[model samples]
Target: MNIMSPPPRKLGRIHVPAVTLAHGGGGKAMKDLIDDVFVSAFATDTPRALEDQARFDLAALAAHGDRLAFTTDSFVVDPLFFPGGDIGKLAVFGTVNDLAVGGAKPLYLSCAVVIEEGLKIEELRRVAQSMAAAARRAGVTIVTGDTKVVQRGACDKLFITTTGVGVIPAGVELAIGGIRPGDGILVNGLLGDHGAAILAARGDLALETEIESDCAPLHGLIDAVLKAAPATRTIRDATRGGIATVLNEMAEASGVAIEIDEAATPLREEVRGFCEILGLDPLYLANEGKIVLAVPPAEIQAALAAMRAHPLGACAMLVGHAHAGEQGRVTIQTAFGGKRIVDMLVGEQLPRIC
Candidate 1:
């Protein structure tokens, strides 16, 4: 069997010290930047012609499944680089997870970057290479992209928007409405690591911890889950709004009540203490590598076993279960033996957490 090597590091150099308006002028400067930075980093078996759009062979894509899953997301994390990942890795996996939750085999991604004039050229190169490495790990391609350099004051140092396309296998159906009373709520790993890690990275709180963002690609984990529990009702990546917001959405969509035990929710001691110090709720905190799944009771054990067997889902656990109660209501049994409503956050708890 042939094995694939990792993507090469730091493909090319940026002659300029900082990005300037000329880089976005669509002239020679822009072409050179594209060639040296993006092309070199994302090179594949097939040569890229630097075309306006990426072309895909119909037959090659059709082989994966019958339906296509498409999703797009934007990243503007305050710190471009974080403990476990950077903006580029977040952009790639963010869209990949969006497609994966829909039971799609993530295949391709489109990256568009908006860079502020005067931004360091090295920063741009680093982000591109991070994106390439992430794509290779996720088994997806960054096929086409656009770059725009705006005046320094017009935007942050850098921002990225990624669009992903994937194929959904035939006969696999997952929908929010499929959730019913008695279904089990499962999570792939400890919650709120990304949110806590980013908060600490900001340094405003003067707090310190060893927690790292759980940013990762989940296609392999999701595949293992489905193979074990084909009757899963829904799967969602807990991103910006965290598990609380995602659960609220699922509960509302399915018109079912969700009740979870706080003790059953897996959390790291570091994250637990961080949330306590900041008066933050882990449920409202963001996570890049965590997933909230609704599976039938009979298949819950099987799903848990499969998730534990996978690297990404090693921390998987049964967090809660669905039941008949007030429609669209979510309640949590507190550690103090009291129950309270776990509603959607009224406002942003931590901005740019994704």
Candidate 2:
């Protein structure tokens, strides 16, 4: 008898309309599912050998920069799909922003997904394609990944985890520890868009608006800031806990104080209205595309100019400043000429938001 081999490429549409337990059994069904959905969608200039891991040339990566940056994040946003973006796009850009804010040029990512058994295969393909598009836009590649389908109710409709690696240019320095008194605080765009969008999408509040997630890749904007302000102290993406939580963390980490003008904090009317209606403070909301930067006073204008010149930073504002005072303290000058401490959130404000 003669032995035959599998096809060199498994490029075809998914046969089954929905996932099943067999898909997670690591059998022929699993291979077909992976090939049809993830492999095909993630195709790139790189070879698709479907190896256990991806390999890169050290010399090739070293050409871009000397230091390497690595970060990982998991996405389990409710509704899976929402206005302005979906979980797939969020997973990719979220990790990219992590590496970017660290002053790194994002390069590659690993996408691992867990799908509920009843999920539609088309939905899975849609998410994979979206992730691929986001990676391309961010100038990065999804080089490897894993997939698993759990029993019905074992997992949500889907959950995605992305791990990214980037390279930081030589002569670049940034960290919370670098924060100093009199450093200017700036945000790239409107805050609470993501948090508000998700809240409204869930339909729990019986409220409606046109607010959309501010999800985006920030590496381009970050590069612009670095070029204009090389002495920038630190850059942090305001995610789960929003800008207020980020400021508190920075103050605590650096043993300094952060003071922001509540009047100067930029916000969209829709977001502000949404928060007001729900008694939610926009400061404590999550933001996907915004960053909090601490820049030396002398370089503040340069950094702001560079940011505003970018599409993502068009609404950028000088919201706050670091100062000398009680360690780990954050004070906001209210619009009514009063001051209040902007403390970290005591409990989960909006859970399952990216």
Candidate 3:
């Protein structure tokens, strides 16, 4: 009998472990994954059956009936080390911004670590120290945690998952679906820098400028804007799928069509050059430390003024507006005045992007 050749040592058609494309397609795949992973990971002692947001006993939270905000994320970006920040800083900024963008004053964070065997303890210390420093800057604390170790290759160098809790004052409310026709869409400065910086560091290709990731914490900027104009109805950090996907989310949630001016969305010169060279849309690239805001037509000026005062918001600009529709469509006008539909992104990160 002829010996069977070891299945030709090769790469698979696709890489990375993730739910199917339909997972982000708003289907059973999405719901099941949320129910299984998200609820299970977070709802150990709390009820997992029903609730739009996690329900907590306020009796223990503080004195008065204060509104509570909770947010969580997993950091698994390649190269625990990156240009502007690392996994540690990302852990803190990522969660702090989540709370801040939603109009909440962040209070505390819970960090969990999964480490690979054979990793250096000193490296672990450095990441942890960075986390401590970041938490201090964000004015939050790492209140609790759990640690787990796996055999080498069973995990990456490290992975950090953080959950944040904050309180929102009365009269302050924002929702993804809060977008409306005539509402102005604004984005805080320079897109694609964070994502492209990571790609460049991989050294797979050479580019003109040695760019740095725009990874940052946006709490300060958000704080300034909300203070100036309380009418800000929505805030979203343009992560995962970037501005286009985020705008699409706004359109769906508010049941309105969003119209964006391609020329108005800001892109750094190097970022624009790299995206153009590689045929990528600056709109769909991820940003670690940026924000997208939707506010009333009348409050646009105040919003801009407030944002411009904060260093992070200096480059902020109005990027779009909403229109009447079945509540979930997004359109963008090209520089030449052509209209195009912006769809939700699907599949493993295309284009070695952020």
Ranking by TM-score: 2, 1, 3
What are the TM-scores, per candidate, against the unseen true structure?
A: 0.95, 0.96, 0.81
| Candidate 2 lDDT by residue in tens digits, 258-337 | 99999889999989998888899999999999999999999999999999999999999999889999999999999899
Off by over 4 Å in 2: 1-8, 46-48, 206-208
lDDT value, residue 195 of candidate 2? 96
**Candidate 3, residues 1-354: lDDT per residue as tens digits?**
897534422211212243234433445554553344333333334332343333446675654227888999888877777778788888889999999888888888888777675566456656777787788788886666655656668777778899999887777788998877899999888887878887777777687678888878888788789888789989999987889888888888888988888899888888988988888887888898889999999999999999888888888899888878656888888998899888888764544332
User: Which lDDT value does model 3 have at 244?
Assistant: 86
Alpha carbon lDDT of residue 109, candidate 1?
Answer: 97
Error of 3 at 58 (Å): 6.9
Candidates 1 and 3 compared by lDDT, better number: 1
**Cα lDDT listed for each candidate:** 0.91, 0.91, 0.77
Q: Clash totals for all models, in order?
A: 0, 0, 2
Evaluated at residue 87, the lDDT of candidate 2 is 97
1 against 2, candidate with superior lDDT: 2
- Lowest lDDT sum, 10 consecutive residues, model 3, at 7-16
Lowest summed-lDDT stretch of 10 residues in model 2?
5-14
